[model samples]
Structure formats: C-alpha cells, structure tokens
Target: MKFLIIRFSSIGDIVLTTPVIRCLKEQVKDATVHFLTKKNYCGLVENNPHVDKVIVLNESWELMIHLLQNEDYDYIIDLHHNLRTWKVKRALHGVKSFSFNKLNIQKWLLTALKMNRLPDVHIVDRYLETIKSFGVVNDGKVLDYFIPQKDLITKDDIPLSHSFGYVGIVIGAALNTKKLPVHKLKELCDKINFPIILLGGKEDKIVGDEIAAVNEIKIYNSCGKFNLNESADLVRNANLIITHDTGLMHIAAAFKKKIISVWGNTVPEFGMSEYFGKDQVSSFKFQVSGLRCRPCSKIGYKQCPKKHFKCMELQNVEMMAVKTIELIK
Candidate 1:
C-alpha cells in the first residue's frame, strides 16, 4: 500500500512525525511512504531514509493538489489536521485517511481555564497511535534528523576555544514570551562553566551577539552564521543543549543529546517534550511553578499578556546552570 503522510510545516513537528514514517515503512509489507511539507522545510525530510518521495507544497496549492491527485495514494496519514490537510484529503476524493487528534479543545481549556484535560500521552505517542489500525507499532525508534555531508561541520568550523566541546544553546524561539529574556540568557551564559555556542536564526543574531559579548572567549555566537542543517550539525556535535521550547530541542532529542529545556509560556503538559522513544536520555525542565497565569498560550505571544512576565522572570538561572553542569559531568 502507498501512504502519503501529510505534515505541512515547522521543524519540530515535522521531526516528531519520523517515528510514524519509520513504522509505516518497515512494518507494512510492500508499503511506500511519501511526505508532504512546505518547500522551505523540504530539507527537514528530503534526506530522511524512510520517505520514498517528498512532495513539496510550493506556493501553488493547485499545482500541489494536481501533483497529489496523480500519486493515487492508498491512505493519507494527516498528522497536520489543519484546514490545509483537510482540503488535501477532500481533494483526493476517496482515499482512506486517518488524522491524529490535535486536541485543540483540550489545549484551549488548559490555556484558558487552567484545566488539565490532555491525555498523559506525549505528542509522539499520539502520532504513533494514529497508525494502530495498520498494525504498526512504535518500534522503539526516536526521532530522525539526517544531516547531509556538505552540511556537516568539522572541528575547524568552530572556534579554537571550543575545539574540545561546547554546550549548544538555542537562543531563539518562535515567540517572544517563550524565549528566555536577554538578561536571563546572559545570566545563563555567565553561570555556565563550560564553553558555549549560542544558536538561532538571523533574527536572533543581535541577541546572540549581546549574550556572547560578555565573554567572547567563553561564549561564541554562531547564530545566523549557519543554515538549518548546519545548526542541527552543531546540536549533533554538542555535549548538551540548553534551549527554550523550539525546533532545536526536538533535534537535540533526535541526536539523544542531554537537554536543559527551559519552559515559559508553554507548559510541557501540552505533550511536546524531549522524546527519546524507549532510549534513556538525560533531560531537565525548568519552569517557575505556582503561577495562576502560567501557560498563557498553547503557542506564545509577542509580549507577556499579563506584562509581569512572571512565568519566565522568576526562573532560577543559577540552579539551571548547576543542572547543566551536573548533566555535563
């Protein structure tokens, strides 16, 4: 049977879907798997060993739908159950499809009413559950991130000070409230005893510079200097990763790197966390507890809605640094 798995965008969410891809490919006899994602994120799955073909959604939905129609897939696994995926399933006419429950209502209750109705299951497990009818199991495989040879970094690529090893700190997040403030990041950098590499995109270059400015010898700002895969290469080579809830966190899980995941606006109860399948991995989460207004959004906001920003403002940097040191040791 031919399966077209649909997850349109974003780095982490796409990475989380790898287990389903692997199970669908390996367990099912004579099964072919194709992935649909935005053109920009094609690199995330283009090098994946499980995906037979990656159908990129260029700016043209009509063109993409035209292409999907021809594939004549036997089943559609809709990991991204947004309007776009619904439209794609509709456009396919009669192909049997299974969509993972997004639990938006549960998310809304958690964010609005501060109620915890979400299942105990992680998003990765929920993703695996979508294929239970196909008799495919988790297979105890964690997430997959394949770095191409050209994107791989050598010792020469990093600073001489970090030639031995460095902590990979993901300094950027999709939203402002989800990020550790500049002061907090600077504090974390100062407190960490190990060599540090600040990681992010072009948008974070200024903040990276600010954090690395304190001690150029101790902290090296590599944000905006490398592409996505290259950044993943850095995470792959790191001794551990310090990050907000972002794509690199999942990538770090893919590499099974020790992680200090700092939580802010979004809580881990929403089911996104460092998942290493059945493999044992050392991961620590830091979040200020006892805030009534915590988890203000399932995603995040430009600025703190409460404005006190107490959720992030109250985090214990010294303890987080100590934990990082302990994990590294």
Candidate 2:
C-alpha cells in the first residue's frame, strides 16, 4: 500500500505526526509511506528513515495537487485536517482517506469556558487513530527527529565547562503571550546553579540576549546561531531542558530529555504536551490557580488580552529552577 500523510507547517505539529508515519510504515505489510508538508518543513521529515518520500508544497497548492494526483496513492492520511487538506481530499476523488479528529469544539469549551472536558490524550495518539483501519498500532513511542551529521554542533564549538553539562532553555514561542516574560526568564536563570544554553530562532535573539544580560551565571546565547537541526543537537545533548510550549519543547520530548515546560495562554488540557518522554515537568498549571482567563485561546496571541498578563508573569520560576537543579544533579 502507498500512503500519503499530510501536515503543513510549524515544527512541533509536524514532529507530533512522526509516530503515525513510523507505525504505518513498520507495522503494515507492503506499506510505502510518503509525507506532505510545507517546503520549509521538509527538513523535519526528510531525514526520517520511516518515510519513503517527502512531498513539499512550495506555496503553490496547484503544483502540489499535480504531483500528488500523478502518484495515485492508495490512501491519504489527513493529519492536519485544515482547509488545504480538505481541498486535496476533494481532488483525489475515490482515494481511501482517513482524517484525525481535531476536536476543535472540545478545545473551544476548554479555551472559552475554562472547563476541561477534553480527553487526556496527546495529539500524537489521536494521529495514530487515523491508521487503525490499516491494522496499525502505536508502538508506545512518542516521536522521532533525525538530524544530519553536518548539522551536529560539536563540544569543541561550546565552552569547555559547558561541554560537559548545560541546560537547554527555549525562549521563543509562536506568540508573545505564550512566552515567559524576560524578567521571569532572568529570575529562572539566576536561580540555576549550572551553565545555561538559551535556544530559539532568529526572532528570539533579542529576548535571549536580554535574559543573558541580567544573569551573573554563565549562559550561551545559541538563538539564530544554529539551524533547526543544529539546535536539535543542543537539545539532545543538554542535561535538562527549560522551555515554553513551543517547537523545541516537542523536540526535547523527541530526545526524551528531562523537560520543564512552561505554559501561558494555551493549557496542557488542549492535549499538546510533551508525549512518551521520561522525566517531564510542567509549570503552567496549578489547582491553586484561581484565574478565569487561564486558557484564552487554543493557541495564543501576541499579548495577553488582560494587560496584566499574569498567566506567565506569575509562573513559579523559583520552583522551576529548583526542579532544573535537581534534574541536572
């Protein structure tokens, strides 16, 4: 069977789909798995051993359609479940297609009413459900990330002291509201006894610098200095990771590193937390939290609706720092 799986952009969401791809290829007999994603995200899955082929959409849906229609795939797995995937499905008439339930209504209730009716299942598990008809089952593995050898950052490149141990701190999120404020990050770093390595893309370079500036402890600013795969190597080698609910957080999960995931506008109840990992920890949720505007959105915004921005502003950074210290020891 030839199967084509679809998920467009973003690092974490695309990473979460890896388990489904692996299961379909390894568990099913005579299965050849192909992936469809944005042109830029091809790197996320291109190095993956399980996927036989990767089809990237270069901002032209018609071009993608033309290429896919020629393949005449046996099955189409719509993991993204967005409008574009719907169009792809419509065009591939008569192709056996299965789409994962996005559970948007459940997300709405949780975000709108602060009620937690959503299932306690990770999005990866839900993605696996799409392949049940093919008699494929999850191997209880979370997700997989493959980094090319050339992209790997060696210990020689890092400071001699940090070459032995350092914490990976992800300082960037897609939205500003989801990030821990700069001052709070400074506090978290101040409390940590060990060396720290701040991780993020070019957009986060400024925030990373600010956090590093306030700290007396040794910290390396790796934001924008390394490519995504190179950054993954840093996460893979870290003693522990302190991160926001972002792509690198998911990457940390892929490495099974000890994670300290901070939350803000989005809650873990949305079922997008680190999956199938050992020694994972979260700082965003608390029963003592008596705030009505906890989860303002299924995703997040540029800034909090309430000017106070207490969701991230009030995070227990000291306690998280203590946890990071303990994990490293």
Candidate 3:
C-alpha cells in the first residue's frame, strides 16, 4: 500500500511525525510512504529514508493539488489536521484517510478554562494512534532527523572553544512567549561554566549576539551562520542541550541528547515534550508553576498577555544552569 503522510509546516511538528513515517514504512507491508510539506520545510523530510517521495505545497496550490491527485495514494495520514489538510483530503476524496486528532477542545480547556482534559499521552503517541487500525505501533525509538552529508558540520566549522564539546542553547522560538527573554538567556549563559553555542535562525542573530556578548570566549553565537541541518549537526555534537519549546529541542531529542527544556507560557503536558520512545534519555523541564495566566494560548503570543510576564520572568535560571552543570558533569 502507498501512504501519503501530511504535515505541512514548522520544524517541531514535522519532526514529531517521524515515528508515524517509520511505522508506516516498516510495519505496513510493501508500503511506499510519500510525505507532503510546505516548500520551506521540505529539507526536514526530503532526505528521510522512509519517505519514497516528498510533495511540496509550493506557490501554486493548483499545482500541489494536481501533484497529489496524480499519486493515487492508498491512504492519507493527516498529521496536521488544519483546514488546508482538510482540503487535501477533499481533493483525494475517495482515498481512505486517518487523521491525527488535534484535540483543540482539550487544548482550549487547559489554556482558557484551566481544565485538564487532555490525555497524558505524548503528541507522538497520539500521532501514532491515528494509524492504529493498520497495526502500526511505536518501535521504541528516538525521533528521526537525517542530515545530508553535504550539510554535516566539521570540527573546523566551530570555534576551538566548542570544538571539544559544548552545551547547545536554542535561543529563539516561533513566538516570543515561548522564548526565554534576552536578560534571562544572558543570566543562564553567565551561570554555565561549560562552553556554549547559541543556535537560531537569521531573525535571532541580534538576540543571539546580545546573549553571546555576556561572555564571547565561553559563548559562540552560530545563529544565522548555518542552515537547519547544520544547526542540527551542532545539536548532534553538543555535550548537552538547553532549549526552549522549539524545533531544535525536538531535533536534540531525535539525537537522544541530554536536554534541559525551559518552558514559559507553554507546558510539556501538551505532549510536545522531548520524546525518546522507550529510551530513558535524561530530560528536564523548567516552568514557573501557579501562574493562572500561563499557557494563555494553545500556541503562543508575540508577548505575554498578562503584563507581568511572570511565566518567564519568574523562572529559576540559576537552577537551569545548575542542572546544565550537573548533566554535563
């Protein structure tokens, strides 16, 4: 059977869908797995061995639909169940489709009503459940991130200070609410005794510079210099990872790196935490408790809704640094 797995955008959410890809390709008899994603994120899965072909949602929606209709897939696994995905399923109307339940109502309850109706299962497990009818199960493995040979980093790519080993800090998030403020990041950097590498996209270069300026010798800002796979290589080489609830965090989990995940407005209970399947990789989450306004949105905001911003301002950076030290040692 041919399976077309759909997850259109973003780094982390697409990374979370790897398990389903693996299971579908491995367990399902003679399965040919085709993945559909936005043009920007085609790099995340284009090199994946499990995917037979990658279909891009390019500038032409008509072209995208034209490409999908030609595949004649046996089933569609909709990992990202948005209106757009609904349209894709509609275009392939006759194909049997299994969609991953997004649990928007449960998310609304937690974020808005402060009611916990969400299942304790991780989003990965929930994603896999979408294909339960096919007898696909979690293979007890880490998330998959395949870096092309050309994109892999060499020792000369990093500074001598971090050449031996360093802690990887993901300094940017999709939204500001999910990020540790620049001040907090600087504080965390100041406290860590180990060599550190600040990672992010071009948009984060200024902030990365600000944080790296805390101690130029100890902190090397690689933001904006490397592409996504190169950044993943940096995360792969790190002695430890200190990150926000971002895509690199998921990539670090893919490498089974010891991760110190810092949370602000978002919580791990949303099931987006670092998942190692049955592997017992050391992972710690730091979030300020007792903040009623926390998780104000299912995703995140540009800034804290509550002016106080206590969800992040109140975090214990000292402890996060201490944990980094402990884990690195």
Q: Which candidate has the highest lDDT of all?
A: 1
**What's the number of clashes in each of the models?**
0, 0, 0
Candidate 1 TM-score over all chains jointly: 0.99
Residues 114-198 of candidate 2: C-alpha lDDT, one tens digit per residue? 7788998888888889899988887977689999989999988777878989999999999998898888898988888889999
Tens digit per residue, CA lDDT, model 1, 1-329: 99999998798999999999999999999999999998889999999988999998768889889999999899999999999899999999899999999999999999999999999999999999999999998889789999999999998889998989999999999999999899999998999999999999999999999999989999999999999999999999999999999999999999999999999999999999899989999999999999999899999999999999998889999999999999999
Overall lDDT per candidate, in order of appearance: 0.94, 0.86, 0.93
lDDT at 199, model 3 = 95
The superposed Cα distance between candidate 3 and the true structure at residue 26, in angstroms, equals 0.5
Look at candidate 3 and tell me the lDDT of residue 321: 89
lDDT of model 2, residue 320: 88
- Candidate 2 has a TM-score of 0.95
Per-residue lDDT of model 3, residues 289-319, tens digit only: 9888878887899988887889889889999
Model 1 clash count equals: 0
